[model samples]
Target: MVVSSGPLNPKTASYEFNGISGVLGITFGLPLLCVVLNQMIRPDFYIVGLFTNLDIAELWNHIKPLKWYLTNKELWTYYLTWFGVLALFDVLLPGNTIDGVELRDGTKLPYKINGIALTSTLLATLTVRWQLTKGEMPELQYLYENQTDLCIITVIFAFVMAFFLYAASFIPLAHKNGKETRERILSVSGNTGNPVYDWFIGRELNPRLGPLDLKLFCELRPGLLLWFLINVACLHHHYLATGEVNNAILFVTLAQGFYVFDGVLNEEGCLTMMDITTDGFGYMLAFGDLALVPFTYSLQARYLSVSPITLSRPYLAFLSSTMALGYYIFHSANKQKSDFRQGKLPHLKSIDTKRGTKLLCDGWWGISQHMNYFGDWLISLSWCLATGFQTPLTYYYSLYFAALLVHRQQRDEHLCKIKYGDDWHRYESEVPYKIVPYVY
Candidate 1:
């Protein structure tokens, strides 16, 4: 039988996990992070902070005829540029703890920091970039007839601002990571033996089947709110305004949304479970909260009927095939990994290598070392392709996803190098490709 700390409920046998620490966490922690970030960066604009309804002049400030045309090209350019920069950072820096060192146990040792200036600089630049690119011409119908509902527009604005504000809350976590790293290096565990919390609530006790191990609420909650906003405030309005239904648009929107939902709810099984499990709650969540979810939502070009190619039934078939192929690869790769981890089937022989390091040289890992990430890229590419090739912006999400996965793969490789050393090199020698087979 397992013994547990903390208080037990009067009626139930389970421990009452709720504590002042958690309540105090969201209460002071949220505001404190915001306040410190505000002081550090002092961003002129809060992406999601609400102001009184924007008058024409205020709206006009964001409107640029030249900018609209450039928007198509500039968005992708910025994305690619950032991708390249991040890739370079990953490769050159190769170490990502911001300040921590890896322990013998492979867990991150965190530091306590009042502030991290590097994050402030990055946030300042990122906020400026986002503001500059927020330009878009109001829809033609809205401009001419004034038919668009102010309520809808207002809601969209509110959502955008709120999303940014919530996202901004994560900025301090970077500092937290830096500080935690310092602490871990300097202090002994006997002094502070607090086990790091998972990214999502209730992550410590959950059972996991695979990488889809992240908590549902932590991952899905934001998306669910966004979906509600989209369906009621955007999609429904668009449908009521336009009689025609675009099945392809509907399918992709729902599919992508569900994919996000699935990821959030399944807290125990993420691509970076190995890393998340090793880090504290703030660190585990900061990346996903600040980047993945926001970017995923931003890719919805449905608001602008934008496509690279014509959104016809014929093109959709190609899109469907792409989606299906990607799905198969991702699912199969995950299945293969799951099977291997479970110590079963043909992979059993691979696991039975003379030298334990030799195990990575065989099975799915043998194919490309990171066959799963290859499948991930395929899935991302297929999703982007489904949007059709009209505006370059449609492809930005996929491109960014590719770069991110590659960046992550490189980081993982570096960590593996430190963790496994020659074993990792030996494994890499056996399986040459990092992501895509024989291509990358």
Candidate 2:
């Protein structure tokens, strides 16, 4: 068993059966990796040839776009522009540094808040550049065209960055304090004796170089900003390819853009999430945030770029409504929880738990334990609906996301039970459902 410890406990401790997980992980990862590689290299594979009639000439035509992302040096240079600029954006941009959850040491980490400004800067730059271009917009469309290449490069960056963290964890902190401790060098979970597991799962609770935070840079900047850029690129690419942009893709773009906007604007909610609070930075987060999230989550726009699926006004309205509803629930529920945590919301009374933490039983929490997750699922469904029922590939995200959320809810319940014991049961009775209101 792999143990993930809290702030009070050592980051990671060795478990004897480490080989079991290592083997199981390899067994799962290898096949998934192969699929991703195939999706990248073979232009005919991804979401192609499933619904449309096949022709050799069409397949050859599709191969042209793959070359941009598959082999491009210019795309690699943009990484510096993205990371270097975004770092400054985090610093120079508006918003204050807020404290995170109290750690085992009773210290709260400070996170710089300015996701909204950063997003606005990115979108505004893209728009300005598009308008100033000579003939047609080339920068973003080129970026989108070579998106696969950039994603692969970022994956390489993730691995390299993870290795750097692994190495840095062992390096002593500055000698300024005059007292250097090995425990201080490591995160709560990172000292797991096994190198493979430690590298993959990560050992550091939080790793930093001076004031620069590695995890924060990975989580918010590249993947999310790139995801938004890719959506617009898809819209532009479709216009370039067919000379007509489809309504469904536009709706999908707006829907995804809304989610991304909310993610950036309300990033303060991230301070308490598992990524920041409990999980260490390792290959899992490294690849997930850098490569997996941007490319895979935006597959809807990608699919729409090649094959435009036009939806009726009623269908588009339904999609918009579903996404809107999900966003509302997700936002409201999250704010409710955050307000309760930050010691506000006087109108809502909290249920006092034995563990000293308050339970949210009334308002949105009374509907379902993870009301936000249900909303997210609905949003994912709307993305799939925008692609129509052409191929199962488009629906993959929603299917996987649902499973992931259900599993996460179970894990949360388990942890709550361990922490609060009978108090957890009492809280569960009050909140009832895990994710969905009544069905789940």
Model 1 weakest lDDT span, ten residues long: 182-191
- Give the TM-score comparing model 2 with the true structure, all chains together: 0.85
What C-alpha lDDT, on a 0 to 100 scale, does residue 439 get in candidate 1? 88
RMSD of 1: 18.0
**All models: lDDT?**
0.41, 0.73
lDDT of 1 at 433: 91
Clashes of 2: 6
In the order shown, what is each candidate's alpha-carbon RMSD?
A: 18.0, 4.8
